[model samples]
Structures are given as C-alpha cells and as structure tokens.
Target: GFPGNYTDHTIANAAALLGAGRVVGVHRKAELPNYKVFDEKRYFHPGSRPTVVTVKGFRVGVLICEDIWVPEPVRSARAAGAELLVVINASPYECGKQREREAIARARVTDVGLPMAYVNTVSGQDELVFDGNSFAMDATGEVCMRAPPFVEGLYRVDFVRERGRVVPRSGPVAAELSDEASVYGALVLGVRDYVTKHGFPGVVMGLSGGIDSALTLAIAVDALGPERVHAVMMPSRYTSQMSLDDAADEARQLGVKYSVLSIEDVHRDPRDAGRGVRGAPGGYHGREHPVALPDAAADGLVQQDRTDAADHRQQERDGGRLATLYGDMAGGFAPIKDCSKLLVYRLAAYRNGLGAVIPQRVIDRAPSAELRADQKDSDALPPYEVLDPILAAFIEEDLSVEEIAARGFDRATVGRVLDLVKRNEYKRRQAPPGVRVSRRAFGRDWRYPITNGYRRESR
Candidate 1:
C-alpha cells in the first residue's frame, strides 16, 4: 500500500483480532478493467490466483468487483473446493444497471452451480453514484435476497448445507425501480453526498423558471432540506413575466428561501467599467450579469443548464459562444449533466408526480435561456426530439454519420451534430462535475482530444 512508483493492489480479505489484527486470508482482484470510467490497469497489478478461506467449517470463495465479470476466477474457486462465493463490488449506477448485474450474477452461479452472495457499496463518489442493490442468489440462478437501490444499510443472507451442497434460503427481495425513479434517485443521492462530504452549509442556484432549473431546485430541497437551499431569481430585460411568475411559484411551493435580484440596473450602469461588465456578442447581457452574485456569495453555486448533455452538445456547436465561460457554466456540481433534453423533461414530469413541486406551466413552457428577446432552443439547434437521438447515436453508441442517417435522420444534420461534438471538447472539459446516469457521460466517459483532425463524412 505504498504511495510511491512501485504500484497499488486492490484486495478483499477476512481479518481476525488475534491479540491485535491478523490477516486470515486475502483475495487480490485478478481483473483490471480499463473501459468507460474505469482505469484500474493504470495503477494496479492484477493477481493471478483465486482465494478461498474457511470460516465455521464452511469453505467460502472471495472475489472483488471485476473478478466476477469473468469465469476463470469462479471456476478456479470451485476447483479449489469452495462451497459458496461472496463477491464485493463498488459498481456505478446507470439506467438498467441492476438488471445487468443480476443477469451476470445468475450466469456465474449457473456456471459454477453454487450459490453466491453479492455486496455493492452505496454512496456518491464524484460523478459516479453507486446503487447498493446487493443480492444473494441460489444455485439455480434465482435471486433469494436483494437490498433496495440508493439506500445504505446492512443486510443478511443465510446459507445452509442441504444434500451435501450449500444453498441460500429464500429471503426478502426488493423490487426494481423504474427508469425515471432510479435516475432521479441517483441525482438526489449524488447532490446530497457531494454537498455534505465537502462540508458545504447549503447550496445556492439560479432559478431561471425553466424546467431544468426547476428540477434541479426540487432535487436540492429533497437532498438537503428546504432550510439549507436558497433560490435566487435574477431576471433581465429579456426575461418574461411568465418566467418570473413561474420561478416565484416554484420557490414558494418548495418552502425555500427565495430572492429576486434584477440585473437590469447593473447592465445599464456606465460607471462600472473595470468589473468586466460589457455586453457579450449578440447583444446578450443576461448570462454575464446574473452569475456574478451567486458565484461570489453562495457556499456552492450549481449550474442548471449543463444538466442536459444534449444542450452541452448544442452549446459546443455554437462555438462555445452561447454560454459565457465562468458565467452560465460556473458551479460546484451539476446534478444531471449526463441527461439529455428529452430525459430532462421526463425527470421533471417524474418529480412532479411525487408531490407536484414544479408548476405545470414550467413543464409545459417551451425551453429557452431567455438571454435574447424571443429566443427558443429550436432557433439555434434542431428540436430536442431530433437532436437527442443523434447525439446519443454518436456519443453513446459510437455510430457513424452514415449509420445514424440510415435510421431515418437527415444525413446533413447527423454530420453537423457529430462535427459540433468533435469541436466542443474544450468547453466540456471546463464544465463542472455531475451525476452520471447513462452508459456514457461527458467527463470520464467521453475523452476526445481537444486538438484532433479526424472527421467523418455524412455521405
């Protein structure tokens, strides 16, 4: 466990306090994964052997997270006379990830014909949110026990020897969560842990009267109570009266401390020459003036727009001109940065179902930044219905322009979207961290170089 040039080893072991602490047995992880947010091979040396330890006259096999993904480790353990298997994990949460985990566990158990116990950690670590849906399976690949997702608690599973074979007894099994519930739960847990673990007293975010910010505010209050959340509405000349009403209504319904700090005066003042108070290109002064207050005054400032990865793709396509650096993108954490615009609406509707915190008008209103007069998202980019699918094909599925266009999309649109994604790596590099709820996210999931000359043709 030295912190020098040698290397680090990840292991699972059983310990006994014989006078002091005695290491009875150890199982070093044999698989070093290096794909999609995992870079264990960069820092770890893989062990080549399987480990089984005896406890209370029962022989148990020990495995780490990645060790269960492959078959060699489990096969070796069975050959070594292991009666049961226990695998410890810290698997990150993604949509339908629990089903995938159980399927994999079932495959391994059926292969070895032995019961297994799987334990996963629960907590938010940076962008990764680990859902602790730990489980125990019988020899026939049936789940005997399952802990609830997004909850932290100790669970029990009992195994008894029957017909000279170890089998897990039937126990309570938690039901699976729907896609929206699971993603929303991940966002709430991610925000709560990021704030509390970093010792922030509270969170302050801009309330723009848009669905994204409304969803973020609801999540903030749910994570840290209404008392710890502060919502500020900084309206500009271009901001609509409907937006003002919706923002105030959202704050009032949530019972959070709210304020209205208009930036029209600051935008018009001529004496403030040295404070970088100049209008940006396109005559949009909205983004610059409003972010200054929360950036300096709040304990933690969260950017709501960056929650939609599809929006980020469009922002990149605008040559990073739409959102000001350190202005709209300034924040400590972005709860839904991995979500798409379509997913944002789905989550908004989902949150509203569980008590109706966000106003109905907010959900029904057309999406906009309201920076310029009469601005709509479709004015700058394709409709989210069209854009999100293209972005997903390129970012998550790694499909080519031709492949995406073959799916009844405009070839030119697919090409343009892919080009924008390629061009905007620098902007995404500077955006704040957020919960990862997809198979691929912006931060560690997508790692395109800033200066690259690769291009794919739509034709």
Candidate 2:
C-alpha cells in the first residue's frame, strides 16, 4: 500500500539508513503512562510487534523505547534473524536511566546475541527531559560506545567484523552538568522549542528585576536570544527604587531591551475606579440584593461603556496595564503573572547565575505588588515565608484549618489565613494567568464562592 494511503497501517523506513527498501509494519506506541506527565495513548496506536523491520541487509529490526523494556520486542526481533537491533525512542529521563538502560539493553542483547543501537531523542518537553544518550553494542555483547548525557548529538559507529575490532571511535561528550544546570538547561530547551514550534515572533514580559523576572529574562534571552526578548519594568508608586533599579540591572545582564513605565498613576487611577468597581451595582462589588435590589439591578446594567479610567484601572488590575494601560509593554507575552513572592526572589537568585548578574539587594528585600502608595505584599498578605507554606497546605495539600493549625501555626493565624484565601478568590479569579509550579495551582484546583455564609470549618 502507498505510505500516505495507509490508515492504521504502521510502517518503518527500514532502508532510511540503508539502500532502497521498505519494512511495512504496524507498530504503535506501547505505553500510555497518562499521569501528570505523559500523553502517548492519545497520539499513537500501540505498536503490534516490537521489532518488525523492512527486509534489509544486516537483518536489522527496530524497537520503540518502552517496548524494549520488556522481552517480547527483543525476542520477536531476534526470532526474525535480526543481526542488529535499533530502538528508536522518546524515553523520558528519570533517575539513572542510562544505568537502567544499560542493564535492560544488556539483558535484551545477551538473550538475542544481537548488536543494539539505542537512539533516544535529546531535548525537554514538559516535566520530562530526554537526555540523548544514544548508545550501541557489538554482536559479542560488548558496549561499543556510550553517548554523552543531556545533550543533542549524533554518534556514528563503524561496525567492523571482518577486521575483528569492535572498538568505538567517539565524539565529544557534552559535559555532565549539575542538577541546577540540568534543570536550567531543560527550561531553556523547552522554551526554545515551544516558542519556535508555536511560530512565535518572539516573547515580551516584565523584567521585574526580582528573581522571578530576572530568571525569566535570562531564560528568554537564552531561549530566543537577547535580540528577541523585550523586558519592561512597569513600576507602581510603591515600586521601590531598588525594584526599578534591579529590573534595569536584569535587563542589562540578559542583554534584552529594557524600559520602565510607572504604574503609580495607573494604580491611583484604579483605586479611584474602586468607586465604579464598588458602586457598579453587580460587577464585583456593590450592594447584595435579595431577588431584586435597585443597586443589584443597576450593576448588571453595565453599558458598552469604555472609561479611559476604567480601561486603565482594569489593565492595572488584570495585568493589561503592564502593556496596554501602562505602556511599558514589552512584546506580546507574559511569564510570571501570579507567581508567589518567594519564587520571584528565588528566580532572581538563579539569575545571579554562574556569574553575578542579579544584585543581592533584590534577593534581600521584602516583596511588594507596588500597586499603591506605601505598599508591600505583606501589607495585604502575610510574608511569603509565613504565607507560602500555609497557602501550600490550604490550597495544595487541602489540609483543613485544624490540620494546618496542628502544624505549629497559630490557630488564629490559620483562621485568618483561610479567610484571606477565601476572600481573595475574586482577585485570584481576576489575576493574570501564572505558570504553575506547585502540586496545586489556584486557577484550576479551586472553585469557591465570593458570597457565602459558611464560616471556618471549625465553626
């Protein structure tokens, strides 16, 4: 059958590396570990046989990544008189996959008396990282070569049997990197691939000069190059001189376009609009009605009205101000919209980097939303050290107030914390979408009411 006309027909180009030949075999992805990370079943039909290859010299057969983890794939390939086995893969990296693969491949090769070439793709997608450590072995079951770890590389081996030397000639090993190095590498790789794959012109975001923005700027610069990154410092009246300064420093360090546009005026305009927001009848604020209150009726009657004040204030509240309202608009993308204060700082520390790019001052300061006069995040929420863990418990762990209190937190504090969380549902609902890094994120795992009579669980 013609390649394009085959539906549910799987075929491998057995002759891609060989002469003109074809191996028409139906093989589907074997594993669908659809947990938090993988989605293979949704995309592929399970490969029927592990190693069915098109007739080619060397009796070569193929196995997918997970298929070779078991015996059937290798057994079938060997039964077919395959002298050399090639396993193409999108194997996810867990701890020590190389060592595990060595053991698994050794078992497969020894049982079959066949040389195996393990070719794993190298890159990051989602939480999974593909460390391209593609390797090979000899028919005598000796490892011919080991590819470098966590990289993109092509390793070719000259299999010599007539000469009787299975010795491997190797290429450069991309040096082993630290866990931080590995994670950082993964983020950069994922960012680059995603942006390029999605056909984005480039990325634009706030360069808050704090850790999160600093790290983000560094990442963006690394991912798309400095020329492609546009960084803005959309400061409010409360934006400390340090914040403004540090954001500038980050943009400089990352070599991206940087600018500051104060949102103080923007902030004030919104606080002023709190009048409309408050009095708008039924918007977010306003008087609660029974079946019908005049105020409630008035609130729902929002016309196709556009207030420069309203747009400006909504922009400040909804994050459009950082671009549209504030005009420090970097480009068309935003990264750290609702990230907690702690991560923001940690990211800054990360940006300090292998070199001292981010300033220590950014790391050592208290975090603030800086949207109002004399403001700090602590003004509205508890300090992150105190607030973050509690948020983790209440939001992520789903611990009741009593359980949270039991963890050495004051009962009063716990009660207040829960109240704040419930109260802030409106803000969280209105806030810009933030990248999720927690076991649970506010946007998805939670659905609560803005108007309710239910008090604390204890009550």
Candidate 3:
C-alpha cells in the first residue's frame, strides 16, 4: 500500500524460511479512526470483509487496532465462525487510556462471545508515547492475562478447547498503575526514545530553582542517566541566593555534571542603561533574558537543550508581548510542554517519592522564573490553583467562557485566560515537540489557525 492507499494489514508467516505456501492469513483493518493524534482515515482505505483463519483446529479472527472499537467487524468475525479474536494495535498512552482500552475490548468480547488477545506496540515516537499494556480477556469480559505498561516483553497464554469453545487459561495480570506513576513512566520512556532514536549522545538543560526545571532534570537523568545529562544554572543579577543554592543542590543530588554561567556581564541592566525602561514587569527583557544563556551553553557542548516551559505558561505568555520570539521559547525538546503548572507539581512530588532527588524546598517554594527582581509566577498570571483548571477546561474540554463560568469561575477571568490562549497561537507554532500525556496537546492534537478572526464575546 502507498501513502494515500495504506492498509493496516496483518500477515501470517511460516517458521521455515523456504517453506512452501507460507502466507496463511491476512486481515486489513475495517475501521479507520480520525481523532486525537490519529488520522488513519486520511491515509488508509477501510477494509470491509472479515478475515478468519484456522489454527490448531480453532477458528481465529484477525483484527487491527480500531476494528474492535466498533461492533460490525467483531460481529462479522463471529458470524464467520471465529472462536477466538486477535487484535494488533499501536495505541498511544493517555492518563487513563489503559482502562479505556480494556473497557472497549470487553465490549467487543461480550458482543462476539469470543475470547480476545490484544497486543499493542511499545515505544515513543515524536510526541506520542505508546504504552505496551497488551492483554487478554475471556468471553465473560474478565481479563485473563495482562502485560505491564512501559515495557517490552513477550508473555504466553494457554488456551484449551472446552465444550466447543476456546477458553483462555488465566495467567499473570500486572496491576494498573496510579495516574502519576503512569504519566511519569510515559514521560521517561518518551524522553529516552526521542534522544536515542534521534542519535543524540546526551541532553543539556537549564536548571532554574523552580518545580518545572527540577522535574525536567530528574526526567532527563532518569531517561539518559546522570553521565549523559548536563545541568547548567545561568543566574542573572536578579537571581536569588535561594535559587542558586537550590539549583546547585539539585545537580549535586542527581549526580549530574553541573555548571553555573553568569550572564550578568553580557546582560545590561535595563535601569543602568538609562533606556527609560521602568521596573522589569514580566516583560520579555526581564523574563527571557536568562533563557539565551542555557541555549548558548548547549551549543558549546554540541547537545540540544530542553526547555522547562509548561503548557499553561506557554499559552499565557509565549505569543503575547511578554515573550521574546526565540529567548525563552527556544529549545530542542520540552518534556512537560503539555503539562499544566499544577500537574508539574504533582509529577515532581511523584518523582521524589521514589527517592528524593528534587529538593523539597524546590517543590515547596512559590514558582518563579527568577529572571527579574522579586519575580513570582503569580505576578504575571492568575494563581496556578485557579488558572490550571480554567486552561484545562478551555483547551482540553473546549468549553466557552460562559460554560466555564457556569462551573463557578469568574466570567471575566475565564474570558481573559481564553483570550490569551487564542492570542498565543503564533508563538506556540514555534514551540519544540514534547511528550503528550493528555487527551489533547499543542502540536498535532490542537490545530487552531494562526490567523483567525473568531473571538468569543464575554457576556
């Protein structure tokens, strides 16, 4: 199949290399999904017929990823005398997608009254992370065998003919992971595969004394080891002593190569230059000035640096007047680019639970960019406790200002946040790719145009 004529086909091959009549079964996916990072309908032609083959005197039905999502294909296979169903998938990871997959598989199994064996691909590709939680379910909708998430291995499930039906024998079932654990695992796997597959020897990143950078450093070290990760603290005149101390402590605790390169010499004080610049007020010169130092440091080491920007901040300031075009927004990859500020703290806490790598003060202190005097995140935007939920409602749930206000938020604040998200489209267009753990991310999932005229009026 070519680009526009692709088919998700499953082929059976014989063990012997020179075996005659090797190809026994072939099945093409009947359903083509076109939602949330999936665009199969744009490239694949939907298959219509069911393909069933015999194996060890039991009739086996073959299906692709989306086939079992609907009832037509599974019902057709059952009508065609299939006693067992085998599904091959490349399902990507979302916070609760494993349970969703099992629920859908159980529906198909119940409809056909046939046991199912599901196999999903594992690895990270670009912004997508495929968690390999392959599983098997009996006809009664009980999971018989399960594979752990974020791992690659082969497991066996025995099946026996019982009273004219193929019953899958119960096997080991790995327990489901908590939301934080699952998301952290996805981020770790995503960073590891992205760096290794792209053939980069290692990664370098800025280490601010903030939760976002601390979490990013921990993720980088976990993914590529401390030897391969380089953490640099580029402090400015406004950088606090607490920030410097915390940054150094993080690197020392993680056992990574650390450096502190002061940008104060090259960075002219806005007040000293007498440029008529007032006090630094969350503007580009104040906030993004230090961003360039870390980027430049990565160039010296011949490694790409990761940015610590999260989705909430990016949406609020990136394309607006506050963000410098290439200063803070510049980086090769952003591990938490899709995460909100609230989620960033959650992940940091989760990582520290394993073994306290990130300093407790880093997580406990107020969030700040440390780029300007007495700077704090709340100085620019709404409090994260209030802002993250509004962003999630608008960006992920596509709710209008009124709908969000109905959820007990101030209408004016909701309107303001939504406006910033819409206004920052141009800046987000230039952001680096990051692991997507939500139902929608900035890059491929959210596709609002850069030049749009539509605006929601606040009532």
The global C-alpha lDDT for each of the candidates, from Candidate 1 onward, is 0.77, 0.54, 0.78
Which segments of model 1 are wrong by more than 4 Å? Answer: 1-22, 269-322, 453-459
By lDDT, is 1 or 2 better?
1
What is candidate 3's lDDT per residue for 1-459, written digit by digit as tens? 112233335332111111135656667677888988988777666667788888777788888888889899999999998999988888899899999999999999998799999999899998899999999999999999999999999899988899988999999999999999998899999989988888777877777777778898898889889988877777788889998999999999999988888878756653345344455435554456666554554456543343222221333344233344455566677777777777888888999999998889888898777667877777777888788888888878988888999999988888877777777788888878889888877888898887856665544
Report the error of model 2 at residue 14, Å: 11
Q: Estimate the overall C-alpha local distance difference test score of candidate 3.
A: 0.78
lDDT of 2: 0.54
Leading candidate by lDDT: 3
- The C-alpha TM-scores of every prediction are 0.88, 0.62, 0.90
Model 3, residue 274: distance off in Å is: 9.1
Q: lDDT tens string, model 2, 51-165?
A: 4554433456766676677787678777876666777777655434466777888888878777788888876553345767778866555677767765686677654444532
lDDT of 1 by residue, 50-72 (tens): 78888766789888878889899
Candidate 1 has which clashing residue pairs, if any? none
Off by over 4 Å in 2: 1-28, 52-57, 69-71, 92-115, 122-131, 137-151, 159-173, 276-353, 371-459
